[model samples]
Target: MVAITGSSSYNPIITINTTTTINEKLTPATFPQWRAQFEALLIGYDLIDFVTSKHQCLAIDGTKSATSKAVNFYWIRQDKLILHAILVSISTTITSFLTSCKTSHEAWAALTCLYKGKYRTRTMQLKEDLTLSTRSSRSVIEFLQAMKIIAYELAIIDHPISDDDLILYILNGLGPEFRDIAAPIRAKETSLKFEEIHDLLVGHENYIRRMENQLASNLITTVNYSHWKGGISSNDRSFSNMGHRHNKQAIHPKATPSSIQMNLQQIVQPPHKEKIKNGLLTLLHRTR
Candidate 1:
């Protein structure tokens, strides 16, 4: 093999692809999503080194050779492209403060300084929100989603909360009806992920709703059946009283067979048909 003269290879020039636009401009409230999108794009292109300061600019002076000048030009061009990407992605409110920043690293650091400074207060507020969250009338998925959003925000601010703590927060916020499920999860020694617990909670919520509906239906059916039976018993009592009174009048001590026959005939012709039929039958049977 031939010996290498200057070097085997040279560092490739890094370039930022400006065609991919960041969807939203940076604002105080939007920093987390905006940072994520921007960072992901930079990372995918392998140009994150510019903003992180891992790629430093070469120095240029009167003593520098043509090769040094060419390298410095390439570095400066790439830096300007990255800086432009950052400036355009920011809102006018924050971009005004970054006007003096000339390099990608400076802009990136400035943004972090401005937003990361508020992490302490923001983290406290997020924690409080998560702690106080309640399911109330909302669906289980909605409740879980709300809590997850707060957790995500916390993570973006560099204050990541554990899954177990989040699970505890969820159990605390749920109604007492969920105690059956909550107790077992609380007692488990093994670590559980959010996805597994999510399915369990949702399924349990549906079961509870079904049980409540079934109980309500049974109660209604019982009340209706009792009412119907009571109506039949009341009518029977009225008919029995009519029959007994007719029979008592017919068996009077001084009454003759003819008089009893006349009383039975009268009983068969009037008022309620069922009561009349039963009353006449009772009188005839007693006379026989």
Candidate 2:
């Protein structure tokens, strides 16, 4: 839990090392590899080591949130930190939440799929970072990103991020019956009285209504990610020039070419996690 500070031209950098405690917390019935990766991402880099300026930033990731006790270490970097302030689908992870992050409204059309619309407030999340800038430093893009971040991370509610047609499906599937449910009403706190029952009923109804909407929305998300799996974005122009939108339709029935490479860094690869498991097993076997 020790924090060390560093500085850069753009911002201040904070570093923390939680290896000792995190190693103790590692468990068998969990995503140990992901947890270890998170631990490394945290201790491996300086939490805060840059300037408190604009051009550059130095930040660290958090566990669920500053307050949440669950050691769900999050993946955060300067780029992801910017997700709610100024980002676009094409720009970077942070900017993707805002409308103005892209070059044109057309670009926004694609990025807009990430928006979570709870009727009045489209942001499915929120954020509180006093160090980055004043809350007053709000813009359409920043506003949206902040809102969605809060909603998804804090509320366990996510803004729908499917295609336009999927959005239309969500609206249609909601069937206008759930439209007037009034998010404020659902958000209101109820005591242990019958009011709680009433609120619960209302919540259940809304959830039931959302079932259809969610199903359709999920399909689009899957399709999008499926496309991404085939390698969607890359910096090399030559890669970009190869083709946009890896054609799912073009693959012949005869055979599937290309081994379908994956990011070895993520998912399957868990650093030396396997090695650790083997080492532990060896110790147990020798004792036996």
Candidate 3:
């Protein structure tokens, strides 16, 4: 453990335990997420100033005075503590990168340059991702989230995306389903925030689902009505057939013996010439 007092008025004296507090080890692969934690730990112990060379003691004169010796001792002790803390916070692989460095400041610079390259490479990748992003295969929510992540990464690398640009990207990448939502947003006098746009998209999605459900219900109802009408038409034809059969039975009365004899007499009998003359004479007398 080492106690270091900060020269800055706002920073208080801090005690750092190299064994416990510096347990988070960093490597080339894990440097991005681990950098913040390591830097915060250094700041907490008030030793970051030493690593940045902000707290170096002034060079003493060649005289062997007690005050000069004391100043040299204090400077050496503070520098050693900061260097040791940095060493303990990284893995052996990362330590190899700093082996030639003799001071904490040198090691800090080396690490910053190494990670800056990684950061630049990451920044380019995020830019490409943002450029190639589309909503064709993913939901609107998923597309928006991916764009936001890319924007955040770009901002981290000192290349922040503007709100207007973000909105345009969202609109351009969206599927045709979102055109209605995009139209109104684009027509607005002022641009909507990302949150506002998200809400509007969600609302539109719900509306589309409701419309689809209503259309499906209507189609089902139409099919059922047609089926019912067809059944009624079949029943009407059956009733008409029954009525025709009933009328035929009413006229014939099941062919009793009297009705059979009448039908045979009409078919077999022929009228005589005298009978015809008598029928004509009877009609003339009636007219007179």
Task: State the lDDT of candidate 3 residue by residue for 172-233, as single tens digits.
Answer: 88868888888888888996888988888878877976776665444334323443445324
Report the lDDT tens digits of candidate 1 across residue range 113-179. Answer: 9988777888899999988999998999999999999999888767888999999999999989899
Better of 1 and 3 by lDDT: 1
| Clashes by residue pair, model 3 | none
Q: Candidate 2 deviates by what RMSD?
A: 29.2
What ranking of all candidate models by TM-score puts the best one first? Answer: 1, 3, 2
Best by lDDT: 1
Per-residue lDDT of candidate 2, residues 160-205 (tens digit): 3323222222223333344554344335554233233335435656
Off by over 4 Å in 1: 1-20, 60-66, 231-288
Candidate 1 clash pair list = none
lDDT of 1: 0.75
Arranged by lDDT, best first: 1, 3, 2
State how far residue 68 of model 2 sits from its true place (Å).
Answer: 41
